[model samples]
Target chain A: MPTSRMLRRATPWLMLAPSLLVLVPFFVLPIAIMFRNSLARDNPATGMLMPEITVANYARILGDWFYAQIFLNSLAASFGVALLTLLIGYPFAYYLARWAGRRWLPVLMWVVYMPILVSVITRVFGWIVITADSGILNGLLLGAGILREPVRILFDISGMTIGMVHRYLPLMILPLANSIAKIDPRVLAASTSLGASGRDTFLRVVLPLSLPGVVAGFQLVTAVVLSDYVLPTLMGSTRFRILAPAVFDEAIGSVRWALAASLAMVMLAIVAVTMVALNLAMRRLAPWARGL
Target chain B: MAVGEAGLDLEIAGISKRFGSVRALQDCSLTVRRGEHMALLGPSGCGKSTLLNIIAGLDDPDAGELRIRGAPVADVPPNRRNIGVVFQSYALFPHLTLRENVAYGLKVRREPPRVAEERATEMIALLKLDGLEHRYPNELSGGQQQRAAIARALAIRPVIVLLDEALSALDKNLREEMQIELSLLLRRLGVTTILVTHDQREAFTIGDRIALMHAGRIVQVGTTEEVYGHPASSFVLDFLGSASALPGRVEPGSPPIASTAFGLGFELTAAHRAGLAGPVRLYLRAEDVTLSREPTAVHRASPARVELSTFLGALKRQVIELGGHQVLVDAAAGHHGPRFAQGDAVYLSFRPESCFVLPEGE
Candidate 1:
């Protein structure tokens, strides 16, 4: 019985052992090695990494205006994408959670995630075709007289944003819908009966109650967009610089492993700080959402 | 306006609603006097809740006129109707503390912060939730949460209060306690309140007048005693409480006689017969029928065999066979009377005035 009791406790960890085994060596070990490499120096003549503990790489990136501008631009883009997805996804999430018929909800949800089912590269190519200067969007806009001429969207930040929003919208919507669905419909009715207008009820009750989901979706989109490489690389022109591509250039194009590792560490630090700050803000702004 | 319309606080006239092919409410009409407590009593799905929703302006009726405080509110939205509703689930905002929940309506109305705080505090105290104001709804017990919800509803001081099966979620003891507390509080506040419930005892406890509903219609509306004693139909008799029904026919006479199918006959007053002349079902409340070991001349006694006797704490309930029909009898237990066993022979009798001779197939 003693042995069996111990076995019962150990069974969970034993089951988790496979994933841990893979993660520790292939994921955590690489991150640890990367952190070590980030603190090292590159040999000037040999073009090879030297095992040295130094902050020179971090110092160089932070001191240089060009590198600092890339970091700021990446942050701004990530924030913008996160906000755009949330603004566009909220009403759809509200409809799905509160108004959609039970029979159609699954079908609607599948439609929302349909774009994700296709390969990202394929989706990027699809976006390229749709967002070309004389693409369908431009044609429709021109035909409707909304635009006097075909606007430039290809190889621009707007095109990159469109592709990214299309790719990441479902991530935002899933959590928003989940939290909104957990809200009791009767609570809304109670609000109405208590002399709160529809707008007031939505702003004072529904929005506050769904803050957890908003925080979750925002954090997810922010982190993913900050490190997103494919969408920007495929959609953006060569002059458009961001941390993800800069890290890539350092690691593969120039073979500057130390600089690449340092850039990746900075990106990691930004993501960690953003997640922590958002979590703290959620706790402060909507404390009742804690544990929910 | 009619003669009595001036004193009315709320009036629902000819309200009807249909969901697809199913009629939820049909030409329902009721009027509540100012400072009156009316209980909408019925079995589940009897259109009581639908009527309540229409009154609260939460749902629209197909054909109806609703007047609150002598003003037509057909075009008014629920928020502007100035009605307070306590939902069955309580529906207190889980994100808000008890104090904030109570003050939400005031905040919506843009009342001064100090006044809102004062009123919320007063309501919290009135509902005995003073110390627990800082706790969220999920942190409170069911009874406490229900009190908080009531406090929140009452904080706005609306023209009328609607309670939709509000106490159905509480345990029996807590429900009974809250029933007394809520009724007393509503009486003190003098608010025209409507309580919708399926529990007969709850209706009797909280309602000054009971509007008994059946099949999407208000079958009978009267005082608690009147509705219980003089049910308009067999459905009302069956729904209010347990009863023993005997199929019979009404025999015409100066005072009509009710004759059962098995040759058993009993004299009935004209008032008890209620104009049912042909086939009828005589319903007798279980407590109205009494059992005795020996025959007595105080009332008409029928000889019967006790089929089942159950000692239910304060009362001894026995099922007796009379004229090939089972009749339930309840006698005071532990009294100076002979107790009957399962097969004991006994005499059953009940006052003719207490029996309801309703028309058959009603």
Candidate 2:
């Protein structure tokens, strides 16, 4: 009986052992090594890492105007992507969660998740074909006399944003839909019955109740966009520098491993800070989200 | 604009709704007088909630007209209809404290903040939620949440308040307590209310009139005593409470003589036998049937063997086997009555007027 009770207590840890085994070495250990590398010195002459603990790499990135600009640009772009996806995804999520019929819900949800199923690289390439200067989109605009000349879309910030939004829109929508779906339809009816107008009910009841999902989706999309390497590298031109591509360039192209580790650390710090700030802001603004 | 019928706060006529192939409501019509409390009582999936939704304007009836205080509101949306609804879940906004939730409707209608605050405070006090104003919905107990939902509904001063299985979420004791508290509060406020519930006792407890629904149709609608004492059909008799139904045939006489298959014969009141001859079903309430050691005058008696006897606190319930059929008889659990055990021979007696006779298969 004692052994059985002890086994009962240890069951949860045993169940968790596999994931912990994977995460400790594959996730936590790498991060520990990366942090150590970030503080070490890189010998410029030999293109080798030297085991010397210092803040020179971090200081260099923080003090340099070029690195600072890339960091700011990455933050701005990630925020913009987060906002755009939310604007586009919230309505779609609301429709899917509240309005779609029993027969159509699964089909519509499949469509939302369809983009995620296709490889990201393939999706980015598909966007490239559509947004190229002489591609179908520009050709149609020209043919329809909407534009005299083809607009610059590929190799531009707009193109990169479009790709990022497309890639991450489902991430935003699924969470929003989950939270919105959890909202009892009866509550909305109650709001309306209490004399809140359609818009008023949504603003006062639906929106506030679904804030947990919004915060979740916003954090997910922002973090992914901040560290997203594929879309920026393929869609944006060389002049368009962001943190993810900058980190890739330093680590792979320039072989500045220490600097790359530091850059990666900065990106991780930004994501961590953003997540904390959003969480704190949500707690302050919509305290009910915590209970939810 | 077509005027509403005088003294009626709500009128639903010819309302029908179908979901796919399943009919949710079939031409359901009911009217509520101003300041009346009506209970829409039914089993689950009987379209009671659907009817409530249509009245609240949360759902549209496929073909029907709704009137609120003389105004035809078929075109009016839920918010504009000015009906307050408390859902079964109590549906209080989790984000808002009790005071804010109660004031939500007032704020939406653009009442001045001071007036909204005062009305909300008044309702909170009225519902005995004075100290819990700052607590969110999840923090409150079920009874408190229910009271808060009612408070929120009443704060708007709507013409009608609809409660959709509102008390069904509470435990038995809490539900009964709230039932009394809610009915008193609603009556004192003089708000025309429609309470939808599946519990018959809840209907009897709170409703001035009860509308019994079966399979998407309103089978009977009357005052609590009227519906309970004189059920219109076999379904009503069975649904409202526990009753022992006996299959029998009616033979015409000065007073119709009802005889069962096993040769037990009893006379039925002429009123109960009106328009019925041949086979019929006799419904006897447990309390209507009396179990005695011997036959007595003023009541027809039949021999029966006690199948089971249960002590139900205030009453002693006995399942008696009579003429190859089982009958339930309830007697007062007091010191004077002789207690019957299983397999004991007894006489089951009842007055002719207490029987509910309905045509077979009705």
Candidate 3:
């Protein structure tokens, strides 16, 4: 082959070399190291990692019902939070994209996006303040004579779910709003003019078209909620053992690095399988975004 | 008051709309008899579209009454108004197949599944869109998409159909072909229809009556011949086609005489002369005037110079400068007259009755 033709062929790979350089060292190497570490054995007395090649860590995690239950609980919480966020976010997104006039849309966007700007710790503290026994919610219910006593909210699943929804709502809404906005207003008009009511128009046209964004937002929110550490620690009861908190406990308190690595690998596997499944669902449901 | 008549389909009365402070429509009123095709024709931003949107119930009028059949429906929502619309962009549901898109209205109305499918199939065949029903809108050609849009609108058997510049998106040749095909289809269906268009030629091809609009008001409404041949105003004449106007003074007499500053004179028709005085504007269609190399003593011929000659297919458009006034004359391509160059001297003449006289102020 001519040198010029060889150079031309080399150009594309050369352009891609910088991204590959970062990926190999930062992502691929770390994952490989983690997988190797997960197979090592820990000293029985000190719980320190030792050089070995075994599936003991995986056996410990899979054999123990406590660890399996923690994993299931985390997956369930993330799935629940994703659904709740979507239910709350979809209507607001629709309003912002379609009905809110120019005058109020900017103001509404600021409100929707404001929580994201605040640190998650600070927002979680805000949730604590509001849901605490002597908080404003309890005070309001007591003052309004709607309750006999203050209701327990903080340090419970409800508090954790609420915090997760608050943190991930804007994530769900932004994508949904964008997809809804791409729909030509004329299509809505054409539907209405063809004797389809507003409800029918939305069910038949708007919802199906906006499914790609919904699925994308669901996957993103679910992944974030699944692996979240700080939120579960702050808002959840100590009795509740989600995967992230358990991994932290095994590594720092128990000094079981192998167990922690194995649990981390399991979490990674769950997220990977979920993302793949969600991607397949998006393609099947909204094939319009085929390339993406 | 007589809206209950069986022949009436749509009757709009004293309709007005304002977008913020700009008056988008004002007292726009028109009536369409059953099976009539009314074309709302105007230039862009002329409020023809605003009026159509109001009639379609997609937009509300500040003050007006709209009646479909015999009953008022101003307060009704768009979907409840029982009207079908074909938009300029077609606005086909991108996610649905052609069959699904056509069946959408029926499905929305909660027609049984079997009935909706049957109606969609019928409409597809009606539009000659067979064998392409399963394809998505993006997969179809422009003309096929257009036909699909029409089929979708007609599937519900709407009381009336509204086409909003529906054929404007196609190429010129295809647009003309669709225009004829659409006219024949509408005739066969005998559905009351209103077509909003900016192109006068399209209006002429499709509309039973052309309603010329200007600045948020309907200026003239009549048959194509009535509106084109005897325009009601200077705007109407100027909008409909190319015509040269000569500002002249009218001398009152049993039959008034009009003479221009360029020494051209003509006798005005009786209707044009009634209760009129002072200056007048006389318009002559380009095709109405003939050009010759030599002056004919028998005709009222005026001297001119050929400024430019443009070959327009079978007709040669010769721009004649007559006494510092420019007028276009369309001569036959095979005329036996000597071929005229850029600066050739010529004489222009036309039948005097063909000239239309309007008030000078207009």
Candidate 4:
């Protein structure tokens, strides 16, 4: 028989326990294992794994210039792509949300988001044709007497950057559009009535207030670019490597699970820390939007 | 000297807006004197908000002129209009601190940060924002948000302050308190203010002059006393204060008087002669009728029978029948006067000045 006192206290935990049980193994266990393995190193002669932990995985990545270069390369590619996406995507989303047609919203939505359904390889293929030396973009420019020769538009950081933006553009656009849509048309009026010119209102209130969405987009684009593999694999060459593919190469192809696990843990930590920073920046800029 | 920096003279001439076939406003016009508080009182969808927006330059009227002081504002945009509007919803920047919200317009004016800070601090002090300057709109209660909104609007020191149902969001008690405080603030500042509200009490309490609008037109505009006591039309009388409508006609005489079944006879006073006519409606305030014991041949006294009396805390409301028509009367509480009960004969009298008559064509 369950006492009333026991039932009162025990019921909440009983209800919550199942969810925690499911989450720990699926989500938390993998992370914990990856973190633990990142520290472990085996002695080759003993042919036995030494559970003895060391800062070796971190030190190895930090110490080697080759690995350090890859990490910086990853930062440059992700940051570059995310910046371009924000610059281009923000206005596009704002225009569509603030001024688009009542009936054409669905049509516009389809146009903007249809790429989400297409395969990454297929999308990258289309970009290759468009950007290739003899392909549509070059042909158009050459026909117009703009370029004497086809530009180097493939197998480089630029091509990968373009591919990354194409893939992550939607992620930036949706959050941005949502925030812009939430602005009361009245605030714009209030802004102007306060002696802010059209440009000033947009600059001071609309743009600044929308910074949360901008930060969110930036974090998402960076995080997505960081995690991505296919865009780089297809559009980029081996000369420029990112942290994700490097780790993947060691873990699966080179059959070094310990090193890969350590890298994964590092990647996760980087994401968490960067997200916290972005969140802080977002709060600082659009502290009012949190109230909404 | 009557006008302040922005010059409170507001002239909205022939302003009109139409959506599809529905005309939200058609040639609406109004004017406010410098430093006077005016209320645009109306029912919902009467284009009161549309008029406020026109004044704010949020919506340009299709065929009208908006002039602040004597300057035409034909091409002026909302931000450039230099008017401050506090919305019904408070429209506070939720992300901004109370002080930041107040400083928005000052910053827009390119005021130095220190000056803006000083002005914002002054407004915060004026509005009694005190230690709550750091609180966000969501953190404050409804009344506090309204004060912050007031502070923000007034901090700009625009010529005309527009209040679009600013107190509608607050609870009844808080709304009344804010209304009094806002009225006092407007007076102390001597800034021309236009308030839009559906609540008549708010309109009467704050407005020196009131305009009652209905169906996108100004039904009447005058001093609250003029609009309330001497309603120009039947609508104005019925709209502002509660009126007991009784159908009647004027008896043939040099000094015309109304003969209705509701009462024995009602003579038109000097103020109520506008409706001296053959056939018309008589609007009598419930409180105008006085009940007295038994039958008495007195000034404007007519014998009547008592029907019902109700006690309403500090006042007693009674219904006495005069010539088969029921007349309502209110008096001091706990009055057992006339030893009144159901079906007792009595005398009811009303000063000729208490009733108003509207012309028949209306």
Identify the candidate with maximal lDDT.
2
Q: Assess candidate 2 and give its lDDT.
A: 0.89
For this target, which candidate reaches the highest TM-score against the unseen true structure?
2
Cα error, candidate 4, residue A157 (Å): 1.3
Task: Report the candidate with higher lDDT, 1 versus 2.
Answer: 2
Residues B159-206, candidate 3: write the lDDT tens digits. Answer: 999999999999999999989999999999999999999998889899
The DockQ score of candidate 3 comes to 0.64
For model 4, residues B1-362, the per-residue Cα lDDT tens digits are: 23323544898778889878889998888888999899999988999998998888877778977788878887877777778899888887766788989999999899999999999999999999899989888899888888998899999898899999999999988889988989998999999999999889999989999989988888888988888876777777767766766677886576787766544566676776653677776667877767666443222345677789888888787887666666677877865555578887777666767776665557
**Model 4 chain A: lowest-lDDT 10 consecutive positions:** A41-50
Candidate 2 chain A has its poorest 10 consecutive residues by lDDT at A283-292
lDDT of 2 by residue, B262-360 (tens): 535677775574767898888889988887777544223556789998989898888988888888888888847777779988876778778887888
Candidate 3's TM-score on the B chain: 0.95
In candidate 3, which residue ranges exceed 4 Å CA deviation? A1-24, A44-48, A142-149, A288-292, B1-3, B270-276, B296-302, B323-325, B334-336
| Interface C-alpha RMSD after superposing true interface residues, each candidate, one decimal | 1.0, 1.1, 1.6, 1.8
Q: TM-score for all predictions?
A: 0.94, 0.95, 0.93, 0.87
How many clashes in each structure? Answer: 0, 1, 0, 6
What is the C-alpha lDDT profile of model 2 across A141-208, one tens digit per residue?
A: 99999999999998999999999999999999999999999998878878888888889989998998
Residue A150 accuracy (lDDT) in model 3: 92
Report the C-alpha lDDT of model 1 over A1-292, residue by residue, as the tens digit.
9999999999999999999999999999999999999999987567689998999999999899988988998898889999999999999999999999889899989989899899999998888778888888888899999999898787888988898898999999999999999999999999998889989999988999989999999999999998999988989766668879889988888888998999999999999999999999998998776645
Candidate 2 residue B32 C-alpha distance from true site, Å: 1.7
Q: Mark the regions of model 1 whose C-alpha exceeds 4 Å error after superposition.
A: A44-47, A134-151, B1-4, B261-264, B295-303, B321-325
lDDT of 4 at A287: 67
Error of 4 at A76 (Å): 2.3
